[model samples]
Target: MTVTDTAPRALRTPRADRSNGQWKVDGRAALNGTEEFKAEDNGINVRERIETIYARDGFDSIPDSDLHGRFRWWGLYTQRKPGIDGGRTAQLEPHELEDRYFMMRIRSDGAALTPEALRVLGSISTDFARGTADITDRQNIQYHWIEIENVPEIWRRLESVGLETTTACGDTTRGFLGSPVAGVAADEIIDPTPVICEIKRRWLGNPELTNLPRKFKTAVTGHPSLDVVHEINDIALVGVVHPALGPGYDLWVGGSLSTTPRLSERIGVFVTQEQAPDVWHGVVRIFRDYGYRRLRNKARLKFLLADWGTERFREVLESEYLGYRLPDGPPPAPAVGPGDHVGVHPQKDGRYYVGAAPLVGRVGGATLAGLADLIEQVGADAARLTAFQKVVVLGVPEEGLEAFVDGLESLGLTARPSLFRRSTMACTGIEFCKLAIVDTKDSAVSVIADLERRLADLEPLLDRPIELNLNGCPNSCARIQTADIGLKGQIITVGSGSGTGSGGVQVPGFQVHLGGGLAGTGRDAGELGRTVRGLKVPATEVADYVERVVRRYAAERTPGQSFAQWVARADEEALQ
Candidate 1:
């Protein structure tokens, strides 16, 4: 594809150089405690210490500096102590709530996993993590109950399968989310797997970009479905076919969700496939140099984007970083279908890809091993994971399709799941997460089961999937604000403030957000859900609350109206 060729301009006063030689310092002082410590030592250096010291000496040997901060660079976090209820989540300190066990995240860029790799992951989970494995929204696999003693062995097993947890967490470039059906999708605009691979190869563990002000997320999708949730990523390249240039990518920057949620903006630039890697590198470097470091809350690239605005951001990215002006481009076409490629679908080849949901990404070790066996038995090419916490088995021959589907059913995975099963998503809540205020995985599963039975009659009236994203906290790990029904886990007071148990009570619950949706999911653009004032559904009554609202939606919505559309225009009384 063709692109604009603008000569590089000489640098005058570079914004990235504002920090000077001080790592986290502005002019005279360190930004925060994190900045002060991070300046003292490179986070990546902790690997040697882990391998030589902590692994041998055990959990207590780890210093708080490495335990709380540096360990995250390698995707390690101390898991929540067992038997700790949601009520005590915020009451206790981080050290008080943390157990000796750990939660390790394994990066799975491009969502591609071979049968052998699947087997290894299953083995790792079974042996090291007490059989805990959950597919994160970013396509990484998370394991709980990990120990410092087993981390080295876990790394060895993962590396043997061409996987590693480096930069999976912390203030680094996290795993790049790609379309699960990247190269295999029938209607793909351009296979983004190559770009993802190229960027990973060059920058995955590179020390140059190892330490950013905060975590930076990247999404690359060539599928027309926009499968990678591009609008919510820090840097995204959406597939587009220029009128004259044919197929390439449209640059999008500064999308993120958390306490401060912001939809990414298209930078109005077209980039050929060859230029993608360098462009990605430049943007990240810009963040590393110019991003906020003073306060942890304002450190995300989104805040910088807000300060600079899209036009100025693009100009700096071009002149200061890329050293070349990219061609102006059109926005991506509206998504043609559901981004989550659930159920059976045809691949580009004569073979097929069967997508299955596993109850909001909860796939245990034995099940993963079973999947590997099934893949081999069915002669499928590979198994892929989706952003929606589902798995897709690719290259299933037409002849073995029936057998593969049956095998998936036997494993509690469903290619043809109910709408609730297919759309509901949840984060790792109080069960394992230290930051969580309420249960999520179990909560989401419960909601899906309840809705499947309660709203079965309303299914015929629904035209599109109604997404329910359940998050453990305000962090939005499950993209709570981008679902038709977003439930943010919180502990709310149920009765008047007076006494214990019955008189006044702080109970595990959720604050509801309605009508949120992304462009890929049917809205023309991304929209955050609106919060209903003074509305809190107790954890025990979430199912009842959802059922009541949904039944009302089914009874009142106009013809051909999407759940988001109806929720947007519906009155608060109808929502309640």
Candidate 2:
């Protein structure tokens, strides 16, 4: 007995009239609003069914209604190459798609992991995922090449270690993100571990929240550095202090980035550390009830927030949900940097936390297993996944620092990497993602390698960090909008219609964004990158263009000028 077996599938909102016996939910979105569609009609309560029925029956056993939609509720996405042989992905119909191997996203809320959990993740990746594993910016590990038959066993292994794929995708409370150094950071205002655990405990499998108009993302962090990316989540409980209330959270609502990017706005309400979970529950309830259910793209809480604004939204949360008025609270500290959290930094305790920079978040199962072993060997209790796709090993004693560093180096993870390597980020691109139009990971790696070789002599000039982010599509999966060097995918014809050597060639390319950064006085802050008009880089020439830009910055920067500052004062021509 599940939603599929009992809920009123024919029910429609009172405001809407039925058409052709289907609930035609109306839209408020101007872009893609007119067309009516039913999100729930896609499927109902398929998570457990996937394990109990679909996995046992094989891929063909899944009805079309489930394959394209219900499958995602359990964190399964068909990792198909939608656009074969260089055609536009969007132009193709569903029937034209190729391949059925799935991608499984394992939610790791708060970047929290135990060595035992790591071992489970690693073994699963190796045995079932074709050695494929990636640590996402959301503090999750995604595996490509997952098969239908193996999902049940994967769930068993994962659940044995206290991990789950539930609500990791598909319009539910997708997942929660917390500070990687939540309990361990020296300057943390509060530890978010308890809150993260509380959210999952209360809401993870609650059917009331399982169906939503679209995805909902939430982050809770008390770290002073704002390490959990409060501004980009639908609902973020950022650590703040109310003068009378002492330590609590400031609620932020509706922040998200995709084709339409909006920073989450602070709701001016202070929620007690204990009340944070309730506030979260209430806000999600609000999203579920009143959020746009028409257009899938407009279904995010951001759209609802946009139309309602925080004033009314807050009123509803107070009057209907929390049953108490939240008091005004101070804003969280402005981000000091891009919040990379890389390298060795001291914790409140005497021990040090070393953030190891992986190669743009790509690590094999063997590598992850080795990391787990190193954590045990080095006397560290846990490892954290940072927002920028890096690992921060916690509780390493001062005496064990040397051992930890050596072990990380042996694992191809380094305590200190090149500035580019540490800050570089890329999305899972055309290699696995269906929406992607270009290759991101391989191109990013090549660019980083080329830059490292060419800029060997320029290291002295890079007194501060620079971020290079690559996204396979305009969806901003790599946080491309805020990158110092943002590369968004597209197809471009690079010359006259009759030519040689990349001329008149329609190939994968990236739109160039320069000087984008989180802002600060000399070397810190947050700001979106400026787009260079008429500038796009072919995939093959990404390295060359990036090298030229960095070289120019090195040669021309004024005294004490950071990359962001240099780009601020630099002419657009000079940047290009």
Candidate 3:
């Protein structure tokens, strides 16, 4: 159990500092702040300024078991209703905000900007009160509500423009995710922005790999296509070539999807690009020294490679990388092609990188500072952020791709192509998860805007792309069994009294499931369909029964069928 005897389990503070709380700090006040000041307030230590702002940013003062201070107090404050907390509580405004936690990660065509990073992200939305700044599904840029004593003056104005909240979110090593058109796409095969800037310069602020056993994800794509799902990642490298092992990368290993969904295990060999950080420090020190700490539902790292299996977790990660020497490379060029930075392309230097569509990946803070002023008026080298929430701007110079798609449609932002926010995904439910039970992002944008206005003229019925995923419970944290119309929220029973009243009683709803798919040949694990009783149906008649089962699979499908292979050739009373 070593890892200092599996810590985590003490944060319950908040005795009405406007309750709905959390607070903890100590460990030399989280490492004496210096990312440009603010940890020095020293008012007799509030757990030493939250352990010196988590050790001046490097982290790991203690606390593990997936240390949840409500994921660092709602990713830095925004729960109000008492004389409206911090940013003057506008019950909901900024463009009629339906709370999609702001997003925007600009760069592609504007080539990785800098004017001190757009004047430190426009002075962190003009002196912290954040109110909007998002672009993450991994391309990075998030700054929603923000306000917990203005997060040490928004971390001293995002370290005076250099920008950083440090490893951007717990369990460390986050925010290094690459390929929003890395090094200009045009079927690129190996560029991954200098190995994602040397894996964010040796694990951004490494304090001996900041507390683990969970929440560690990594990816680097070199574009052998496979559009950045980078095998869901516990560690993924991608890009290939290897005519006698040359270009590098094919690692993969323990993919994930909360509530234990597995799907990433290839272990043993192929790493080049200079032994990708010694195979990422021998698979994160064999999951921080033999994973599983008495099971918090099997602590991740794909349940320690499913309890030491993948050839004994690659022989204890080659006996703890016995002094590193493994890079003999070779084996890794068997058809790793096909790219999808979604839409428009061209860039081996000639320049171009569009891929817009931000719908369900929402965005606001003035469209995230007009996507960082269109990467400071085009020129940040390149900018990316896909995993399907979309952004991809890159080098663009075919005469500035029609004025950067007409300046992202005059800042209302949209690169077109919409089918209810590209496949939909909802999580921060019960209005900011206290382990939600409903309201998953306004019932997944009101059931995908009533099933895209009732399948608007049955738009080519099905034939691919269907993922729905709406987890308010079952703690799947929004992986909803790899989605294909997943749902999961359960509590049913509409009237007949005794379940309390006021808001017209009858509690929970949404159990659906249906042909869940994840695109792994067997087409993404999906089943358990039927359970739509959200108080006798009304989430737009349960999205009009999944849009009349996709218009009866577009009039009895065939021809390259897919919606989970035609819900596996419908049966069981035609899928209920």
Candidate 4:
């Protein structure tokens, strides 16, 4: 199937004509500032400028338009400076908070990596980014401390390894998330590797899709584990079998999180493997043509779906984009395994794949390089990064399994991680993200260590892992709203202190959200966590609070009651 280069219909609709191409309403005749700037120049055009002008001339050569707006198109962002506390996050301007260095995101489409590719990533991190790298939830590798002058060489190295930063950020199709064990899993319904590869080849660098109303995320998964967190992406295709058509994908759309969180709604469409790429193209094009654009906050596809609803959306997609109707089909079967994929698992090929957990996604360049050596020594050829911020090394034979596990442990990766370590997730917080209001990676690490020690006795009482997601802001970059214990970071007033009539000291803290979860936990659909009134957890006391609430759940839960179920039924007093 061919994705056309035609401009989206919204660009030439009656609304566009009325506003003389500005696409405004109520005779306002004014586009949002960001939209107006994008119209002046395509964000991709900055790539040439970055290579030719900024790389040689240095960071000061970048104008504000390109620095703040266009740079994100290529996955570059100015990281936050050290020593800046959460209290000052809102008081200072961006330039004051930002460091000269950049954070570069490497889009690992399908999260697959060869030994050679892994080495290159390791070397780049060590040589260019001060040995710092993070495995993001969307299955991309993020590096910090990048300089403008080093970007060209970094891009060259990534391209050599068949990886890229293109559309890894900004208002474009971000990295496509697939099941980490896409092709090798023993019980996968249908491998999505081919569909993922085809979609990337056809539309990855296409200029037509480089700009959208806002970021568009996509996920495809064949694993019953539901490993891609499909319920919260803009468009997701979960593997399922049609009653008569055999195995295919079920379409879900409009899932997102932030200050306003929304679970994706299935539009009752089934897609065959052959039609997957075309179906994805059609859905993205529909989003481009008809999505909200006037308000930046309202530009995500979720808002559009909320307004149009699923039935009208399906009709428009078929008529305007696909030119054909998709058959109504069944939703996926309930997730049967832990989505994180931690520990050893058998592969369909009679070999084994080992899933290892890194501490809250933190792995240094040296550790990664060492992991590559272990993979080669163990005769493994493939590795994948998971949505839960873990790594799976594939193709290990029975003979090398013991040695491989030892090697992973040496590199500080654990195939057998504790429940707390396996379930906790954190975003880049005040340490690197300019928008973050609190520290996340370090805070999460501390909490994990504490929980492991404190919750050891209660392990037998738990049947499922309780997801603890920590975000540095209300933006929900860590998928906080869909975690069992979602923490949105903010500064809260606490304790009577000098210089205050109301008497309080400002401290880094979180607003707690309980019972949020996705379909992987066996709920019929994704559910957002509910917030309790007047509950604020200080950053320092996260471990203490989590321990208290968990112990309470363990004591009070009935037989076969999941943590989410307990939260749903418990009184407000029990939650605290």
Candidate 5:
């Protein structure tokens, strides 16, 4: 009923005892000693105890072949129900596995056609009989609802495409994320594509670093804008132009979002173009060594940074980087162009790149195939997908821009930038994810449609964008905290009074929160507003209330003012 702020418990370290030859003790008994004989015996006993526990819990590893049948092998799995079988809905299970999904990333080098890769994808689709492939936000392709029986065959097929599923999941480093418009953007400070490739080459499938305390994420931005939500990544290298170092980046470390969301702390070290890889490795090593593993919830790099303050974290990183001398790099210079890659823009080569809007980040199978065809026709100098759920078709010659734009229009995809659509995002919700409590995608679409209909009278209100984010659960995958209008699903009590023997109570529809924002230049988006009980007002009515608030307080704001600023300036009680 209420969003409670539960403080985390403090970490406790075991105390050491010096009474008996530098022995370790818990309470008052001898725990371990420096004696060689006792230490060997202790190690044997510990290993035996661990093996016993693993056996009792059935936590041993399962072969890749039996991944599907052994549903509980990984502690959790996914599958489909009979008759509910095709489409994305079949993938959604509240708390059970029907099938398993595996993902792989491949680099195509902007070539016209990779028949081998296409063959592999098609073969996997056939082998699984039910698996569907979708491209991810990070320019990687994911094959979902894969049957366990086809794991080996799928791997073989992927191998033909220069792809592998070995390090895609678990605690290993994921696919490196770079600006999709890497070399194609007109105003790029540096092309991060090669950088990402180098990082992946150095880290992927490395057994020595495969087992980590938690999964790690990293992003390199060629654009000044944090288009990849770089600040939320475990490691972020953002390109900035410094007068002294020419073009370089500032390294951000230990940032993540989950139940405990924290902004990354800057290390104050500017990485030169040549030293980025070395700096990245040093940060990962620090996290691997110092990250807490015993406490699963507190195992993230952010928690480690919290334990050791930013200064201390940097000191350890510096110690790690002692041998790898970096070139002299200076602070970033001011950005020259707009940060967003959403509209059509000219490339450095005098070509145009069209940013196509993919509503809700969903494109039909036919549409996806069509996009691939278009890319083939346009030449894949680069194709980028922004964090805002839009795709960019880069490096089309200026002469062909008109034709390419027409082709996009023919496909029902447009380059027109709408403030509402630009600022909206929703997770897959009930459509695919099991943890979703509400149909967030549908709800978001409906709310946006209604807002458009009601706000038709208020034209020229598109100067400033107002983010409206909806998440089905508190996981915040949609980044609800950075929105002007943030709506998180919550069950409210529909009826009051004692429950009758025959009568039943109604389930509450949704709980809405407003004005949560990320910290930076536009940091203050205020806190949660009032809990709008669904029983008294329908969900549709809630939309109307939001419209009224937007129209009242944000109708005639100053040039640079946002809806969030309006909310902050208004009297809290009146708004509530």
Candidate 6:
């Protein structure tokens, strides 16, 4: 079939069975797998609808599908704020919700940024969004408290800086991630920026990809840290060297984490830097035509990759999409350190790039704007955001290194941070995210501060870096399942005065998981976190409990035993 023929409509007409709430094929519910929505022509109509209808008519104008599904294409979502309960909220109409504001997201194809772009971002947040700005795990800027009236202005500002919200949140080829230190890293195998630009140039808002079974995610990284979380995207181009081709990308398909967590599998093909975009196009087209569209939960590219396996997926791509075979490639280099670009690193260009960490990826408009000034003042050519929620200022001259570090420090952005401060990650919790269960940003800040204070004496023995991810829910948007210490927000009953849940009540707490890590970082990476039975910690006491566990690990660990290895053999009682 031609590329145009790969559209979802050209495929079989879906036969829906919605007896189980949503559309279902065999008693299993689907996302928007109903024949009705699929038969509605195009999901992209929301763009015109928003401009002509919704914006003109306010919140009440949103149709159910556009409110929940189509609005995402423009990076808009009605965030259910505080006082909005779990039940009934999901079923309620967007206008019926207490808060009518939207959470606006701006897509960055390569996680790349510039001073002009950031100023626009900061302006949008401070001017229109009430100073609420967050850098998401996917390396995009997210704003809350946005209204329909403000969207036009926001889009205008964004467009002025060469940024767009199109396909940022929809069931299309959402934002693709690239290395935070893409062109500047000293140890990078290859720079993937050009490939990312090519992909965006060809398919940013192309209508052919606007309608898919479900949302799609992609990442391309050449850094040794595996900077983009390669194992967790639908299609990832990881840096690898071919025996004859030198530096190129190794292809991986079908990685995702939600209720079902699966690390991507390498497809064993070497794609030259020039050929990367075509390969990407081929894979996504294959997904469009052959992917499972019958079940929402099962419609991710991972499901197709899982069922087809890497070999078959590659075979179809070669035969149906690219019409040519690709050369076999080698595996990515093992990770040397954490992917977050915090701290100072010398670039290959004899300059320095500073990766400064903001508290748990939470930064406001003025701060981001201030950072834009710093980037410009320091004579840095550009700045980029890391998947780790850190920002990297690139092209700093050697003379400006000291000034740059001090400037970041002045903004409360840290170049050198404590292990706990550097390692902690938190998702957008109950504050804005509708799916979140508890408060995350401040709680994470509090927990990290507490951990830093109480564990001060243990700082010397903290040789092994720990990954502590606090996700407000089990959605894994923060990749909680792949962290060393994963905290899934929940309301757990503490029978008596227990750790954080010590109020003799079932309050906000976390279901703790241990031993998870992304692959290629340490010698032993890429393992999912372990779940212990009845392992729940009150949010208030999380720091204390984590301290106790770390102390025990330090004292009891065998020589060279990583946290995951120790957790594998340690007595079950010691975990608590």
Q: Which residue runs does candidate 2 get wrong by more than 4 Å? A: 1-44, 81-86, 336-338, 497-503, 518-525
Model 3 scores a TM of 0.30
- Cα RMSD to native, each candidate? 6.2, 7.4, 25.0, 6.0, 8.2, 6.7
* Highest lDDT against the true fold, candidate: 4
Order of candidates by lDDT, top first? 4, 1, 6, 2, 5, 3
What lDDT score is found at residue 293 in candidate 1? 78
Q: Write the per-residue lDDT of candidate 1 for residues 479-531, one digit (tens) a residue.
A: 88888988899888887763356587878889888888898776778887777
Candidate closer to the true structure by TM-score (higher is better), 2 or 4: 4
Candidate 4 per-residue lDDT over residues 1-576, each given as its tens digit: 111111112212223333322122333233578877777888888899999999999988889888889899999999999999887888999899999999999999785798889899999999999999999998999999999999999999999989999988988999999988888889999999999999998998688887688999999999998889898999999999999999999999998887777778899999999999998998888777666677777678887787778999899888878889899999998887878788899999999999999998998889889989999998987889988888999889989999999899999999988888989999999899999999999999999999999999997678888999999998888888788998999998778753245788778999888888888755656788878776789899999999999999999999988888898888878888
Model 1 spans > 4 angstroms off: 1-29, 496-502
Of the two candidates 1 and 5, the one with more favorable TM-score, higher being better, is: 1
Each candidate: what lDDT? 0.86, 0.78, 0.54, 0.87, 0.55, 0.80
- Candidate 5 TM-score versus the reference: 0.75
Instruction: Give lDDT: candidate 1, residue 144.
Output: 95
At residue 369, what lDDT does model 6 achieve? 87
Model 3 lDDT tens row, 464-548: 4576767666655555655656776655545556455633554556656555543321243223232222223334356866777
lDDT of 5: 0.55
Off by over 4 Å in 6: 1-35, 85-98, 496-504, 520-523
